[model samples]
Target: MSPFRKVPAYCRQSRTPIPFRQKQNEGLEALNTPLGAPRPGATRRKPAERAVARTIESDDADSLRAGRRRLGVVLKPAAQARSRNKLERLLEVGLEMMNEIGFDRMRVVDIAERAGCSTGAFYQRFADKEALLEALAQRFAEKAWTLLDTMLIPERFEGQPFAVVVRRMVVVMVRLASAHAVLLREVVRASLRDMRTWTYFSAMRDHMMARLFEVAGHYPEVTDKAAPGGPIELAVQIILSSLISRSLADQRIIAISDDDYAAELATLMIRYLVIDDAPWDAALSPTVD
Candidate 1:
């Protein structure tokens, strides 16, 4: 009925006697000695003491394994501060080399040489040139997001006119783009060929879009059209694209000066996001003297 057989009591009990040995006899003799009385040689530790010693050994082994796990691949900042600094120097050297020779042409040995470290040291931090590039990209992304956070605060533009806010935003965006033009160019180029690079860009774009949406919500004109496909999203995409393209392009090819371009772009965006009654041509056209 139970679909199982019960074990006999004798079968469950261990009946085989342990073989006697010289070590066992010595241990027994040590236990038989009187407490606090000296023995002829080394006395055997008590079972409880032995167990505690084993537990301590086991705990130490476990702690070592955990430390190795934490320190794997990446250097620990606290325990390995010098290693972390070496890694950072490698990245810095790699970034400079990338800017000079482009990512594909850059080599790990060159980076190490420039950093005044060995190739072994480079491998100790990064697995390869691509790994170092990824670290550079991550560093750039963190800095760009930090700059975005400071510039895109809606409260900073509170009570200001839409044109004033757009002007400030465009100025900051253009300035940041110009400052990181070389690194951003490499990142954009890598994104076109590498899925990981593309994913990083996509995630950053999504975060920026979300922030832009939040800022757009402050204005009723922009908020009115803030559905799935919205003018706010389109405006953000166009503004960012324009800034990036301009930053990556030679300045000589552009007809307008940087200041004029920034001003016109800001006015164009403000007109699109606000000024509901103005016609498209009238809003975008230059005023006659």
Candidate 2:
């Protein structure tokens, strides 16, 4: 029997349903509506989505705003092209150094020299190397939000088979992970020592799951919504965990190309969503066959 019989009241389409992309504005709306509030305004979200939104409160919002500000904290005003160019060079050189050498061993003087700027110039922009990492996190977050908006709009998959849509979502995600490989790795390594880092990554992951949940709402065939144990959020976490593990793992260890990896993940998601009478314990079944 399918577990998705009753669409949650919150997810039911309004006469003029709000698109998920616009519903979530890179943390702009902040979802002030609590669960079960009247749907009179533009900021309404389903309770499940609100559950995720609740995690993003004053602290998370402050962190996001701080990141956006710090990204532009160059020595001179970012309005100047030269200062902007130098900032970009510094970020590029810093990442190159971290990949070539370890983050701990990467030095400010070396980074400035490689970026063709003075050490004084680097200091004027970023207080220290950790600040640079914060900037990188902000940059990765921006790239991720843009990609999610572009790829997951409900219109793109209107006529596609469910399976194809799942695969497209997985591919878009895998590419984002590949693009910000270093930043993700650093977040995991440094998160224990820095709550800010952990908060950034965690908040991003929750927002992603929440967005995907909206996309799933469009397809009535998703028959597992009412399953026990927060199944939808759990499934999303499982998929994201795989992406993160692969992003951080040694290529030699995982030994699979991103393309193949994404295909396998798409399969995992489809099976998870379409399974029959399976409790969360049996969700990870033997095979698609």
Highest TM-score, which number?
2
Q: Model 1: what TM-score? A: 0.64
Winning model by lDDT: 2
lDDT of 1: 0.66
Q: Write the per-residue lDDT of candidate 1 for residues 119-174, one digit (tens) a residue.
A: 99877666677666667767666666766676677897686555565666566565
**Candidate 1 Cα outliers beyond 4 Å, as residue runs:** 1-79, 255-259, 274-289
**Poorly placed runs, candidate 2 (over 4 Å):** 1-68, 72-76, 223-229, 275-289
lDDT of 2 by residue, 48-165 (tens): 8887777666446555442235552333445567877898999999888887876889999999999999999899889899888877777777767666766566677676555665
Cα RMSD (angstroms) for every candidate in the order listed: 15.2, 25.6
Measured against the true structure, the TM-scores of the candidates, in listed sequence, are: 0.64, 0.66
Superposed Cα deviation of residue 184, candidate 2 (Å): 1.5
